[model samples]
Target: MHIVFVFRYHIFFYTRCSIPFFTNDTFETQGRRHEVFVNKTIPMVVEGDDMSAYSQCEIYKTSLNTSYSALNMPPSNTSTEQCNKWVYDSSVLKDTFITQANLVCKRVIARANANMIYFSGKMTGALVLGLLSDRFGRKKVLIISTLMHVGGAFGSAFATDYIFFVAMRFIIGVSCTGMYSSSFVLGMELVIPSKRVAASYMLDMAWCVGLYILCFLAFVTRSWDMILLVMASLTVLLFVCLWIIPESPRWLKSKGRFIEANAVILKWETINGKKALTDTSSSKNTKDDIEPESVLKMCTIPNLLIRTLLIYLNWFVIIMVNFGISLNVGNMDGDLFVNFAIISSMEMLAYTFCFLLLNKTGRKRLLVGTLFFCGGACILSVFVMLFFDKSLYWITLVLSYIGKFGITASHSIIYVWSAELFPTKVRNSGIGTSSVVGFAGSMTSPYISDLGKYVHGSFGEVLPQVIFGACSVIAGMTSLLLPETNGKALPETVFDAVQFGKKKADDRNSRLNCFYTNDAFNKDELTGEV
Candidate 1:
């Protein structure tokens, strides 16, 4: 199941970064804001002005009969016209949909729009399919989502029209969310409490491995369509494994499907060489007495409102910062493929460290620490870029990578922590809701990365980093309010979730009072009080 899930996860990052519009540089005409070609250099006029330095969208409406000497001078009173045709630089990225569709200048927003639409689809899927999983079964939703994902991937690969391509990306986004949320919940439920953290880290590590595979595929194929086709073809393998994976016994038991749940447990016991439970009569084939709770219950229920909001905020901030840096890889000073590969590798390194330290440090402290570290690194990079020379740009890049490492670790920790915070009955719903909120961050990330181009000077280069840094720091401070969930059993009900951190707080208060009373008594004895 992990292997299959990893294969499916490969599409997520590829979809985010595969678009060439974000990476390709546009060519502008000299002294003009309009009419320009990409990649192809225009002949320079004798007046020391490069024609390529004109407006990207405007061009002088000059006649062929105009003398070469006139071309040397700026067009005085000559009408400027919008550029009708565009050619993109094909040196780094060849045969991309962006070039094929000519999405440049005024049409460039379409690229960001496509990505936003994809994330919106993911947001929709998280809210809808997450509830469906809790109401139906995880395995059922997983299979259905897997089918949708495969179809979407295929559709994206073969889409000829821009509208069709964006529509297909939307489907891929939604289906990917459904597949991940369902599979993640099921995997978490199957693991014992002691190893749940380890299980969550392993799943994320698999996701990183999938990213590595994606980088390799992108390097080899170098075409968006071919990469999609290849990944889609490989996704078919998940169906084979899906057949063998069992429905989560925890979910089954929570729904009061005891007969099926017990059967699954018995199989596990048998495999482990333990005697099966002989009291089969106790396993009644009936629904649970308690009604299933919806994700909305978290919002309406007074005890859960604050915690839910905090989790949602953390999700939004982490995702925004992480994807903000990731999607902006092209703007960095290095080979695009190598930079992407390095970013992906950083995630793997983060997961490795997360797996090693998660159990030891606990969830809350680790999340807070990583968020702060990421925030500090990002802000420090901005300072370096602002105060230092261009030669020191490499230092900025290294700081940014460090920031990426911190955020990636925080991302992993938050996933495990958020899952632990929710109850089993509404776990998928809770996670789905948080993910839906997070997608909003993902949607805005591209535009945030583009902020550098709009702003002027070195500050422009560091603007996105500044925003990401501030958000991370704020989120880290906010995370301190969330309770730690280490070596604790998964919550099985709303009440359990409500009381998760309160009990520990109460215990600490009682202990403090006890210590004060004992100290007073000792002082009285020393003073010879009766």
Candidate 2:
């Protein structure tokens, strides 16, 4: 089959100054003040100036130039060619990525082994980067994480022995986790709240796109070592991208670089073609409104702790299942590259569907649905293996893929939920904690890979399958009683999420009844105010 090929990658970047601590909030006239994910519409005060304001103070500009295949970073054999030529020979580059299906799969296993450890770092990164961003600014942290990720990727690719590879992979895991958390936090925090959900979703989609590209590479490349090199080389371009992006302006003011913050906001607004809020004059005197509480204390707020813990558990499980199935596809006699690619395709669909339905379905329902789907699939997997020869292998393969789909959806959306749960003070803390847990899960994936080694043939794999199935069940059950966040705003205190969907239903109905009332018989009442 002819594959339509594409790839998505980000260049490395960093904050120029130290991230500042948030204190005065006078300049953020925007609604919704959750840290990590804040209101995107009314523009949060950055450097004490109107963030969305397009003009007035002008030291910079926020412009997004998406140059298509500009540098054409592909495999060594393929040279930069025309778009049509590239498309026709799409399989060429993709094959390079997959030449070592066994190798790639093994490396994926190796990567997952470090995943749990890596995820642990992610959780810790929120506080570290948050503090760093607030003290120095986002740009520098971004750069640091990006370069580190590149180093890790290349490091793992070139390591001479299994131990070195594992250690480097762990380092790669750290870089990835840190980069993922920092980039995501920065992206959402900088965007308008209205833009947040979509932007956040887009960020995940980029990873999916990256996977798609990886699959294509798998199809094209036959060499494992070169594939690693190609993957590592893909990120080197981030160095050039650093020239365009800037520091997190909010972090600047938090760090007392009031003028720099204001200047940054003014530049962003200019690129977006928006006028300053209430005149440019208010920009000069604005400051952050932050308390002195530590990130951990922020997490201890009421329901926040419970929600974060459960969510982390859920994250840990999902990552396990997601990578577990992918890494062990060989046990099922499935083509690792094609199966991995197909599974990723399904994940893309799952995420898209979830994003569309998330607000309408409520977090609890969506989350539960995912867990149930995954659990059900895993439970069915045992049957498929038991009946492997009777057309059941195909069914099992598809079933396992579905399990991946469900968990991927949950994994993708959980970050948004975390962002909403905590207040500005501990928003990063909560997310960081969850990230650490999630990364921990990823780290543990490698060890789980060993599960396949113990299992012999058809019957041998049953234990692994059964364990995976049961884990899903537990995760699903845990989700059943957890809080559901839907249309309602993210709660500031832990107590807010404790009530779950009940609160959202009541609040939603009240608001609708009052504002969107059926006017058939209440024409007079409706016009009373007028």
The clash count for each model shown is: 12, 70
Best by lDDT: 1
Candidate 1, residue 457: how far the Cα is off, in Å: 4.9
Error of 1 at 136 (Å): 0.3
TM-score of 2: 0.64
At residue 507, candidate 2 shows an lDDT of 44
Candidate 1: Cα lDDT at 100: 63
Lowest lDDT 10-residue stretch of candidate 2: 8-17
Model 2, backbone clash pairs (residues 3+ apart or across chains), number: 70
Tens digits of per-residue lDDT, candidate 2, 1-530, equal: 00111221110111111112323322223234422211211111243112332111111111244122322212222222111101011222332222212123124344334344444445455446655644445577778878877887787567656566556555565556556666776675565444556777788788888887777665566444556677889888877877887765544433445567557667866887775341223243223222233445534445545656677788778777776666554334445567657877887888798778776776677877887788888778788767657555678778877888887887766777666555433455556666666656655655655665576565655776676677777887887766554433433222333333343334454322222121111223111211
Best by TM-score: 1
Question: Against the hidden reference, what TM-scores do the models get?
Answer: 0.83, 0.64
Candidate 1 error regions (>4 Å): 1-60, 69-79, 274-289, 453-461, 504-530
lDDT of 2: 0.54
